[model samples]
Target: MKKKTKIIISVVAFVVAAIVTTGYIIISGMQKNLDNLKSIESNDVDLSKISDGTYSGSYKVLPISVEVSVTVKDHKITAIDLLKHDNGKGKAAETIINDVIKADSLKVDAVTGATYSSKVILLAIEDALSIATETNNK
Candidate 1:
């Protein structure tokens, strides 16, 4: 009976260790992904080059992801729609879109506390605009 009890304890300990290790790895990966966002700079897309149409773009970084639809008219941004925003405590970053539209460029500042999400949002906008720029260049 004592041997059986010891085996059970050993198994539980091993299981706990495995769980802890997995959690640590996951947390480390997430931190690395977030850190990578610090160096990501959004390109200033020339709206004049983009045709009059709606473009869709998406960007993901671990805990934060964004999908945006940007509508341009007469070489100007008319509207921006955030179709999907998956974030943890980064909802304030949504206002960053307004800054982009107001500035007519992606070089606007990020939200105060939601910097990671702000960068991700800007990157997604850049991705969408790039499609238009590429199409026009071709």
Candidate 2:
């Protein structure tokens, strides 16, 4: 082929390859994230031994971070409040609170579209639970 034709074809090929490679990387990264989430096992927490106080917990999912306050009363979780969440326009994930209170644990399914945020929030709650468990043991 001519020099000009060869150069043009090469440029087009490079663009296509770049696009495909970027797509693959994005997909693989997302799958890996989901795998990480799935690997996070739930702990069997006994809240009946905790005191009446608020415990704070936090978890970060890269671009997002969530902080929460867990209030225990008479060894039961009486309330849970989100103190802060650096969500990138994904406010709907806050609904996880209802599930938390209902389950009285952080082992509930994450929201459909907000799975990452949900997992992070639950993990934060788990942090609080861990503290409660540790304190109860002491």
User: TM-score for every candidate vs. truth?
Assistant: 0.96, 0.70
In terms of TM-score, how similar is model 1 to the real structure?
0.96
Question: Backbone clashes in each candidate structure, one number apiece?
Answer: 0, 0
- Give the best candidate by lDDT: 1
lDDT string, candidate 2, 1-138, tens digits:
699999999999999999999999987886676678767765647777677789988887556688999998876677889998887555777898888888777778778778778878888888888887787789
What's the distance in Å from true for residue 49, model 1? 0.7
Count backbone overlaps in model 2.
0
* Per-residue lDDT of candidate 1, residues 1-138 (tens digit): 999999999999999999999999999999999999999888898887988999999999998999999998988888899999999989999999888888888999899999999999999999989987888889
Clashing pairs in model 1?
A: none
Candidates' lDDT values, in order? 0.92, 0.81
Which regions of candidate 1 are displaced past 4 Å?
A: none
